[model samples]
Target chain A: MLAVQTIADGLVLGGLYALAAVGFSLIFGVLGVVNLSHGAIVMMGAYLTWFVWHTTGLDPLLAIPPVMLVLFAFGYVYQRGLIQLAVDRSSLLASMLVTFGVALMLRNLLVLVFSPDFKSITPGYAFNYLRLGEVTIDLVRISALAASLALLGALAWVLNRTRIGRVIRATAQQELAARLCGVNARHVYGMTFGVSAAFAGASGAILGIVLPFAPPDEANWTLNAFVVVVLGGVGSPSGALLGGLVLGLISTATSQLIGPAFPNAMMFLILVLMLMVRPAGLLGNAFAASR
Target chain B: MLAEALARHRWWIALTLLGIAAAAVVPFVLMPFHVRVGQMILLSTGLGLAWTLLGGFAGYWSFGHTAFIGLGAFAAGLFEVNALGTEFMRTDPLLGFALGLLAGMAACAVAAALVAWPILRLRGIYFAVAMLGVAQVLSELTNSIEAFQGSLGLVLPRIPAFGLRTEAVFYYLLLIAAVIILAIAFLVKNARIGQGLAAMREDEDTARMLGVPTERYKITMFVLSAALTGALGVIYAHSLGYITTGSVYRTDFSLNMIVYNLLGGIGTLVGPLIGAAIMVLLTQVVLGSFLNLHMFLTGAMLVALVVAAPKGIMGGLAGTWQSWRRRRTAAP
Candidate 1:
């Protein structure tokens, strides 16, 4: 029963990780560029939702769509204007540096405006819990899990079924080939970044409801998302879902079994071991195998 | 032509050496507080060199270098803290310093190997993100462990009355470390390994095909970098007489190192040192004034540097010099 409770709790946490990782994976898959600013966007979305909820008495869930739209536009413009210039550069280091500069700018901006204090969004029912058999779960956690699952399902469907999804996958597989086949790789890349941003925005809204956050919290999320994405597979959507679950279970189990401190070290150790043994991640095809 | 160029630059080299000599002697002549600041500048220069090895040369940007520094400081602190209160465990201060350096390097090597294995497979932005994750994970681990003193942090006991508390001693120590690091950098830049590193940075696949053992070079450079960084951390801890996760393991330090390299001129031998000096001086000016305004000014400076000259101040000056030479040769 204790084990069951831990697993259940782990699964709930995994949902959030999955949401973050999927957005990260989507951008990497479609654009072949890691969005370093994804975490900041996630933080911004959370703050936006929190502010709306605090000032206007709007439901945080209802604020998600508007936030997503705004962030999507922001991502689109960012890629079209700034990132497009670096698209032709063989070394992606320039883009990474640019994004890092942007992140620093955003962080300092946040510090100037919001200060360094931690803030959390607390609705009336934030801590409300529901008990099922011997397992007790927070209502907010359950809702967040459900919402994340729904988003993942919808994303998977869009990737598999939609016309834009086909173009995105094609672009990911071979950019020149896709271009020769009359696909506008640039447009797809921009749209794909937009979608990834929207996913991140939604995740942020969920995170705002569930966790205490400050400006630096974005860096934490970005780091964890990178781990999750790598653990799952760089460009695999389903891999992200499984990776999050595995990471969540490992972290929770390690905390329960050993001490809380051991989990992070253990997680990194596992990641390292996995990389040495299998560089393509657990589910990912080997580099040679993919070729 | 190369020898002639070197001959022409002899005066500049002489001037630089003289500057170093002057800097070395200033702590004895200046106030104690200024000496302390000089010591900090020298320490930061060591860190900047460590960063230069990997980021500046190999093009493998690591934002988690603070982990090594923090580990070094903690190891040294652990020796001083006497957590177990054992007399035999107590060693000479110099031995403690050496142990701290080794332990810090070993920790960084182990952590780097573990983290870099998976992340190294990634390119560009993904790689940077992975490094950030590594830092966060290590910091979180540090925070969660009680033996590490968790958030309260481990405090080092004061050194026995050795009469080495004078700022001049610290200045000399720091200057020696700085020289050693610079010598290493000079040797590395002129060696075959440097050529291989340059090739790797220019293009990895081509470098590998051309018989450069990219992975081995990266790991070796990273380890060396971490070891030097750790040694500097030990020195810093001893000078400050306190160690904390917040101070030792800071992203700000990592970012500042990158900025220093960039502002000085990445890939150049003397860039990081010059960059460190400039940044430290700028920081002093900023911090001397109002807090908010200082940050705003620094931010503005960073923006201007990035926009106006991404190659760095040194690179821009070199370009100008080269253009003037070209025009002079072309005329008449």
Candidate 2:
């Protein structure tokens, strides 16, 4: 029963990781810059949803659209006003510093305004669980997982089947080629950031459904996202899903069997080991050249 | 040309060193509280200078430098904390400080050497990520390990009647460290090794093709960087009179180190010093007024620096002055 529960929990956690990592990997792929601030963006999503839900007494899930929309605009303007300048200067150090600085500012601002207290949203269904013969699962977990899978599907459809998707792919693969093809690479970059942040914000709201969050908790999510990106491969959408599940299972199993604190170290260890053993990550072929 | 340049600046170099030595008195002359604050500023300069080798010079970008720092702090803690499983240095006082510092240096250097081989094979972002992971592992390991007292942390025993009040002594020691680090950076920057590292930073394949021995030089600079920073970590740990795993390996230190280097100007000798002073002043004088807005302001400052002045204050100002001189001459 415990084993079944852990596996079930792992699956739900994996869903969260996949949802977050997709956007993170997307930003990395298109911009060629790791959005170090992605975690803060994720945190922002959760807080925004909670704020809307708390004040208006609205259904928490209803807040997703507005949360996503706000984050999307923020990410877009953030890329154009700040990140584009770094890109223009053609400095990796500048981009990294700027993203990190923004992330730091966001983290601190959240703490300053929110008072470092952990905030949780209690929808009516937060504790209601669906029992499966001898095992039970929270409805929130199942809904969050379904939402993530849906987001992943929508992301896939956009990337694989749409015009903007093609532009994004072209810009990511070869910015100059995309430019020569009459695509505005800069605009595509901004669009990519917007799309990715929307996905990230939605996933973060889903995550907020399950886990109460504090300011520093965002860094934890960011680190896990990095693990997912590395485990899955930098640019592979499917790879992120697979990697997320792999990590979720591993961490769930480890934490269940060992101490709770051990999984963080273990996850990071696996990440480093993966980088050494396979620089291209698990699904090596898709974006092997990224490193 | 090189000889002429040195001849022109020989007095300037001597005067600077002399000035640092002379300024050591300001700490003792001022109130004890002021000395303590000065000590922190000096410590930042020392750590920033040491960081320049890998971060600025070699361009390795070890983001998890907190690993070395934590390890170095623990190395000192082991001697001073006097737990059930410790030996040596316990019987002796002065010998402990000397041996403890050496141990700190060696531990970080060896740790860096251990990971450098596998990590250095990768490039840029990958290496940075790996370092971050390494730090996480080390911090966790420290917290979980019984020898580290399971994160409750250890308090160092104060030396009985040590020369110069402990605070003043540590302050002077920090000043010396800052001076030593600056001297080492200057020497390395002017040497053949520095040029090799510079070449490797610019283009490793080209440097390798040019017979620059890229791997050896990178590891050397990295080890040296770790050793110096590790040394500071030791002093920092014991100076606190109590050290904890979380405090020593805090991510803020690593972030601040990176920001200080970038804020001044990467790859320049005086940049870290200039950056550290400005950062300390901002934190101490300006942001000090805010209840908890320091981090926010620091982050804002970092973003502004990167956006408006990516080359940093020193590099950006120099470029502007040079361009202005060119424009004036052309107009004439």
Candidate 3:
């Protein structure tokens, strides 16, 4: 019974992790830029959702669209204004530094605005729970998990079916070739960043109901996203889902078998080990593997 | 070859020694607060140089060099506190410190060597992130493990200062550490290994194809860098007189090392020194009042620095000097 409960909980957590990481993986797969500020953006989304819920008494789930839209715009401008400049001036590595700098600045901003206190969304259903056999689960987590899966599914459809998706894919595989085919590479990159931020923000909104979050939690989110990408591979929603599920399982198992405090240590240990053993991840780079 | 390189940079060498001599008088003239600032500069310089051994020379930008710093501090702390016993530490504080420093360096060296084989296989950003994972794992373990006492924190013995004030003593200690680190970097930069590292950094596969022993050079540099960083970390822990996992295993310290190297000049001996001096002055002296805005300003400066002068202050100056020299010769 405990094992079943743990698995259920792990799957729910995994759903959230996948949703959080999919955007980061997409950006890495498409632009090859590790946006360290990704966590800050996620935090921004959470705070925005929390603010909306706090002030207007709107459902946290309903706030996702607005939060994501805001983040998407912010992401696009950030990519075009600063990250693009850094990459053009120096190398990809220096661009990493730029993102890191922005991450710090954004974190500072979040702290100033949000006061570094943990914030969570508690809807009327927050106290509600359902029991199936010996396993008990909260309504908030179930809703969060449902929302995460729905968003991830939506992202997968957009990437596979949309005209813009094909263009983005083309640019990822061959930027010059895409440009020759009249694809605006820069615009594609910016759009990809925007889409990534939108998804990340949506995840933040979902996560707000599941976990309490503060400014410093940004680092953990970023690392968690990185670990997810590494585990599942990069650039696709399915890959992120697979990675997140695996990570969620490992995390829960570690906490259950070892201790609660050891999960982070175990996660990082596995991150290094996974990198050493299989750098391409389980699914491999979805877009670039063919190349 | 070493002699030839020394002869080529004799004037620069003289300037460094002269600068050191001038710095020796800083403790006497400056306030304790300023001396502490000096201590920070020296520590940063030493750490930056240590990082440069692998990062600048071998082009493996570790995002978690603080792994060594934290490990070294804890290793020394544990050794001094638990292993050596309080009575032994009390009787011979200096000797205990020396032994603790040795233990710290040894621990870092061993840890680096163990991880080097697998971790070094990763390249660029992957390598950077993997090192971060390493640091995160270590810090988590230190905090969680009851024996490490990282969460509880450890108090270090106060060393005999030879009649000097505590701040001055630490300042001088860090100064010597920085100088030693600089000397090692300088020697490595001029050595045959340095040339091989340069080649490896440019193109590892090509360097390996040319029989440069890239793997050996990388592992050697990694171990050396970790050990040196560990040595500096031990002194830093002593200066603090107490340490938690948070204090020594700071992410900002890791970032600052890279920032210092970036702000000065990557792959240059004098770059980290200049960068450290400028940053320490800016943060500690200039913007000291605005503690809350520190991260914001540092981030802004980093962004501006990357966009405006990607090659860094030294690299920009070198470019100007090159053009000026070219123009002078062209006139003739």
Residue-wise C-alpha lDDT for candidate 2, range A188-214, written one tens digit per residue? 888889988887888778888888898
Q: Which 10 consecutive positions of candidate 2 chain A have the poorest summed lDDT? A: A282-291
Off by over 4 Å in 2: A286-291, B1-9, B83-92, B144-146, B159-163, B320-332
Please name the candidate that would achieve the greatest TM-score relative to the true structure: 3
Docking class of 3: medium
Q: Per-residue lDDT tens digits of candidate 1, residues A29-126?
A: 66666666678888888888888998998888888899889988988887876666554532356555556656666666766777778888888788
True contacts kept of each: 0.26, 0.59, 0.71
Better of 1 and 2 by DockQ: 2
Backbone N/Cα/C clashes per model: 0, 0, 0
Candidate lDDT scores, in order, read 0.74, 0.82, 0.91
C-alpha positional error of residue B184 in candidate 1 after TM-score superposition, expressed in Å = 1.1
| Arranged by TM-score, best first | 3, 2, 1
Candidate 3 lDDT over A81-195, as tens digits, reads 8889999999999999888888888888989988978889999999999999989999999999999999999999989999998999899989999999999999999999999
Query: What is the per-residue lDDT of model 3 for residues B174-231, given as tens digits with 9 covering 90 to 100?
Result: 9998999999999999999999999999989899999999999999999999999999
Give model 1's TM-score for chain A to 2 decimal places.
Answer: 0.93
Backbone clashes (count) for model 1: 0
